[model samples]
Target chain A: AAGVIQSPRHLIKEKRETATLKCYPIPRHDTVYWYQQGPGQDPQFLISFYEKMQSDKGSIPDRFSAQQFSDYHSELNMSSLELGDSALYFCASSLFGAGGPYMYQETQYFGPGTRLLVL
Target chain B: EDQVTQSPEALRLQEGESSSLNCSYTVSGLRGLFWYRQDPGKGPEFLFTLYSAGEEKEKERLKATLTKKESFLHITAPKPEDSATYLCAVADTGRRALTFGSGTRLQVQP
Candidate 1:
């Protein structure tokens, strides 16, 4: 089975620079979620999109923004990157149900993740 | 606010030892509870999802059970290959994203 694909598995950037991370979700999965995991910490929810629309937001920084394209792929753009931003970024995809009690069964599958090192 | 808490910050077991990891959560309107295994420097691998209390799911040497306030992942006759950080997360009715616990780091020595 094809899993979610992430671009630039490893990235290095300097302070104040800009970076863009791309994620291609699994086929037929309509929802994409982004998370950041700092060293020795658990993954934190950043944002999520459902059917190309922003469905939810979490602790994402103001300097960071994300969007899902028409093809169901998503991108996370960060500006004025700080050293504290260094972490592993992960993208997860899930097939969302139309709407009903069964929507609770949506299971998310994750990608390999991108390691960001801000220098 | 939704909160997920995993116990035993770290656990060490010998090959073939059996143990269980706990994840306690507090959320309004629980949507689902999930278990994932993550290797060093890699994304989390999905393990199981329990949608309601009394639900149970299993895969290989792992079994997950959920109740109203907590979930448990039991590993039986584990091998070193099963060593990894096990994360527990939950989704609420208000959001599509998951709120994760810090995770339990399991080290199985062969």
Candidate 2:
């Protein structure tokens, strides 16, 4: 089965530079989520989108932004990058039912993840 | 805010040794509890989802149980291939995204 796909499996960046990571969700999945896992740390939720609309926000930094397109693919864009932003950035997809009224209550399928190393 | 805490940060077991991992959580609305296996440098692989208290689910040598305040992942028997980080997470009615625990790294020696 085709799983969630993420671009640039590994990324290297200098301070203050900008980066964009893309995700292709499984066919027919309606919701996308982003998470960051620091070395030896737990994964933290960044944000999510449902039906191409921003659905929820977490501890993401102001310099970071993300969007989901009509095709159900999503992107995570980071600007003025700091070294602290270096981590494993991962995306997960699930059937629509995340928020109000439409909670499908399904498990999320995750991508292989993009490792970011900020210098 | 919803949170999850897993115990014994790390565990080591010999092949055929059975054990269990603990996951304690606090959430406003317990939508679902999840278990995932993560290999190094890869994303988490979905394992199980337990929705209600006293619920139990099993696959292969692994079993998951949920209660009002926590969950447990039981590994029966042992194998080197079973070694990996087992993560616990919960989806709350408050949000669509899941709040994950720090995870327990397990190493099975053959």
Candidate 3:
């Protein structure tokens, strides 16, 4: 009940097809973050959601968009997937307050990640 | 430009060997430094968070120490289960974004 949950653990999509990944943040955690890790590389920041709005976007393409619902569920949509987009996508959540009334310390709790393969 | 750099892109050690990994940074004001361990196909597992210089934290066989400009993760008598990519990240004072390093891959063989 206090961890990040991502849907569709693995997905394979044809090139140029649309793919969507979903995430459910921990209760009372207002911040949701997403990262993409390619093979043999570190995770790169994709975007973040705070207060039910898109707060930041990294160097990702316009084709990649995310939305946060009122219930703190976030969805990442990729329109027209490309081979380069194939990677493991991770979702994380964190609370904004200063101290440890929150769960899992101040560190973000990451989901198991969604493996997306755009062939 | 905020940046984080990890050294010794890769390392191999026999079981029971000890080693240290380095993470250097260049930022205006450092709010936090984080260390994470990641397996081949999994998300990073948070290990430590250093907020100031001369601060240190330990868990099991790993100890993390921090300085003004860099941080070090020392592994004591590592085992095969310690084999993973260790990533370091920096969160500046003003922003919530985290700048991450390329990471150091450790392979502990039996």
Top candidate (DockQ): 1
User: What lDDT, from 0 to 1, does candidate 1 have?
Assistant: 0.94
Give the CAPRI class of candidate 2: medium
How far does residue B29 in candidate 1 sit from its true spot (Å)?
1.0
Candidate rank order under TM-score = 1, 2, 3
Q: Give the true-contact fraction for every prediction, in order.
A: 0.87, 0.71, 0.47
Clashing pairs in 2: A97-A103, A97-A104
Candidate that beats the other on TM-score, 1 or 3, i.e. the better one: 1
Docking class of 3: acceptable
Give a tens-digit lDDT track for model 2, residues A1-119: 99999999999999999999999999999999999999998889999998999999999999999999989899999999999999999999998654234442678999999999999
How well docked is model 3, in DockQ terms? 0.45
Candidate number achieving the greatest lDDT relative to the actual structure: 1
Error of 2 at A101 (Å): 9.1
Model 2 clash tally, residue pairs: 2
DockQ of each: 0.84, 0.75, 0.45
Per-candidate local distance difference test: 0.94, 0.93, 0.87
lDDT of 1 by residue, A5-79 (tens): 999899999999999999999999999999999999999999999999999989999999999999999999999
Question: What root-mean-square deviation over C-alphas does model 3 reach?
Answer: 2.6
Candidate 3's error at B38, in angstroms? 0.3
